[model samples]
Target chain A: GAGVSQTPSNKVTEKGKYVELRCDPISGHTALYWYRQSLGQGPEFLIYFQGTGAADDSGLPNDRFFAVRPEGSVSTLKIQRTERGDSAVYLCASSPTSFPQYFGPGTRLTVL
Target chain B: GIQVEQSPPDLILQEGANSTLRCNFSDSVNNLQWFHQNPWGQLINLFYIPSGTKQNGRLSATTVATERYSLLYISSSQTTDSGVYFCAVPRGSRLTFGEGTQLTVNP
Candidate 1:
């Protein structure tokens, strides 16, 4: 079976620019999540989606970060006016419901 | 919200050695997981033990929910086992990950 997959394994952009990272979850997974990881640190939760609606998004750092999981299978994390502080590896995971979430390869975003 | 802590922030070992990593949570959790983030930054699921014990190959995990802690054991580790090991527990609808333990296995 196919695991989770993320597009643009690496992305480099200038500060104040916008970038969108995509994630394809495993087949039949009803729950999805997004997280960000800085160097030498663990991943921090960004958003969680149960089905098409975001169940919890408190982890989103600010209003500039938004994520959508339309149709409950694919998700896109959008960063508006990105800042150098946003530079990190963006990770995505999916699960049937919760617990034991399977992770993707992640998209490394670099804000220069 | 729950606080998760990992012990022995950094560890170094020679190939074929065995080691144990621990994770302690401040509150009770219904879910707990262990992951290995490789050099390429891909997080690989190692165990999903919220309680009890389970083993896979040279890796095994045990979670004592009542004690609010989990332990991951790696036996006969190889250089490929060198990476960051993380433990995460669910808080509300999201996971709260610990800072992780950096493991370096030398050949």
Candidate 2:
């Protein structure tokens, strides 16, 4: 009955640095998704994984953003050479298939 | 990409009052969901009604898929209900969310 969980609830880093946000989905969930939310705005899709493979990653802003879920239950969103503009709350969600996504407490990333 | 629009960008209500939030999409969707983001910045799933109606306690949602709209009704709301309510529909394989309606419930 555990909901999704994210590590390092808050992270602060300098510009051009690298950071990784992890997500632990509910057991038996076969789909995972990543999203980013800026201040006073709705969350924007980042990437999604179905099982161990990323089913759709078009939402990833650029090549600097990459995510992986090799085992299908845990996924990590990695940012390379982070920019100040990349500062936001990174959210993760998991679902039985893709509808009714249950979200986790987002990891707020601050790029200073 | 489907466009989502929510009415009354902001709302103020007294605790124990009733209110309705609306969401309209530009295209038909097979999936529509409502979420509430609390002040602590946690996104909680409220409903996944793509059609018909569903209720959970004092909260209920109705989606008229053919009309491209959905409505969320809160009856006798509480102070804890104050937060940003969002409606999302899939755009491609990912969900596209609305600007969200910020609700303030005063006790």
Candidate 3:
């Protein structure tokens, strides 16, 4: 069975640029989550989606961060006007209803 | 928001030795999970024990919800176990993770 997977394992962008990270959840998973891991730090939650609607997004750092899962199986995390402070690894996870989450390999984003 | 704290912060163990990592939470939680992040930065789910105990191979975990703490035990450690161990709890639909315990097992 396929686990969660993220696209473009690595991404580099200049400050003030916009970038989008994609995630493909496991088959039949109805829950998707996004998190960010800074250097020497643990992963920080970002957003969560159940089905097509976002169930919780309180972890989003600021207005510049947004995510969507229109089809309920795939998700996209969008960042507006990238900042050097945003340089980190973005992780995606998926799980069945009330089950343990399975994580993806993550997409490392660098802002220069 | 809940506070999650991991003890020791770092540990160094010899292969075939046993070690235990602990995690403490500030409040009650509906979900608790343990994860292992390898040197390459890949996160692997180890256990999902909100309460009680569970074991897999050389790894075992016990969560005492009433005590607001969980312990992960690794027996007969191997060099491959060198990595970071994290404990997470759900806050709403998001997971709140601890800083993690860095483990280095030497051969």
Go through the candidates in order and give each one's C-alpha lDDT. Answer: 0.94, 0.94, 0.94
First chain TM-score for all predictions: 0.98, 0.98, 0.98
Q: lDDT tens string, model 1, A29-100?
A: 999999999998899999899999999998899999999887889999999999999999999999998867
The TM-scores of all predictions, comma-separated, are: 0.98, 0.98, 0.97
lDDT of 1 by residue, B1-107 (tens): 79999988999999999999999999999989999999999999999887999999999999999999999999999999999999999888788999999999999
Report model 2's interface C-alpha RMSD after superposition on the true interface residues: 0.8
Worst 10 contiguous positions by lDDT, candidate 3 chain A: A94-103
Candidate 3's docking class is medium
By DockQ rank, best first, the candidates go: 1, 2, 3
**Predicted complex 2: DockQ:** 0.86
Q: Best-fitting candidate, measured by lDDT? A: 1
Instruction: Supply the TM-score for candidate 2.
Output: 0.98
Q: By TM-score, how accurate is candidate 3?
A: 0.97
| Model 1 residue A112 lDDT score | 97
Tell me each candidate's i-RMS in Å.
0.8, 0.8, 1.2
RMSD vs true structure, all candidates: 0.8, 0.9, 0.9
Model 2, position A30, has a per-residue lDDT of: 95
